[model samples]
Target: MSCYDTNIYKVARLKAGKTQEGAAEALGISVESLKAYESYSRLPPAGVVDRMCVIYDALYLAYQHNRIASGDVKVIPEIEVLDLPRASIRLINRVIQFAEKRRDRELLTIAEDGVISPEERPLYEEIVAELDGLIQAAMELKVAEAKEL
Candidate 1:
């Protein structure tokens, strides 16, 4: 079974001390969209899911950091900083954007007609290969960064 569910999102949002409106704004989505997601009426797209993970992870880190700074006497959980410096994060984001574009282009090539043209086949394959590589690189970078911390 997939680990993703609306309840997890809701719990994380509440834990982060964010109102629905605030979380929606931070996610660059309308409140209605957020509501739909939380209600399980609509599934988030792949890109949106990636952004969701990033946003929630950031919120978690911020919460831990703030709690520690505020002199909370509670046990401080071990926190990891997955966010790299601005330049690195920007580059990683660009790679993801590029991968998404490549994926769309590959889909269009395959969906152009009932059958992929002989000429389109090679191009489609190339795009798919590159897209896989790009996405894998991005995931590896994220995992490695998290591991380092």
Candidate 2:
């Protein structure tokens, strides 16, 4: 089933306090079209689907902000740090190796001072750290795979 087949459209309409006519008017479509969309009797065009997603996302954001403002909800944004498990190591290293090779080309040049500017330094460091992690993970995976063989 498509993501649109989920309750996102219904929830958005309810939250917007819009009847079929109102929603259709807002969306520049017929009431029958809106009904068909909500009931999934007919799938919308790709542009229509994109528009619907944008509208629903906006409505949801408004609802969230309103709730937070009125103290009806305490919003806590989540920060997730994903560390890839061992199985992904070879793929990761291959990607990093490719990137490092690309960086060695003229496309990744710096200024003649041989010193990276402050703004560029952080990006460089982040890239280096990511490549290092990928290489390390790949090495570990190769050893494990070798033992299995």
Clashes of each: 0, 0
Worst 10 residues of 1 by lDDT: 74-83
For residues 21-132, write the lDDT of model 2, one tens digit per residue. 8777777888898787667576556556545545543323232223333443333221111233444655566677757767544226654567788867876776666555
Give the per-residue lDDT digits (tens) of candidate 1, residues 24-78: 9888999999888777676555555556656765334333333334455533332
Task: Give the lowest summed-lDDT range of ten residues in model 2.
Answer: 74-83
- The lDDT of model 1 is 0.59
Kindly provide the TM-score of model 1 when superposed on the true structure, using C-alpha atoms: 0.36
- Give the alpha-carbon lDDT of every model: 0.59, 0.53
How high is the lDDT of residue 71 in model 1? Answer: 59
Superposed model 2: Cα runs more than 4 Å off: 1-6, 57-149
In order, what is each prediction's RMSD in angstroms?
Answer: 14.9, 16.2
True-structure lDDT of candidate 2? 0.53
After superposition, candidate 1 runs with Cα above 4 Å error: 1-6, 58-149
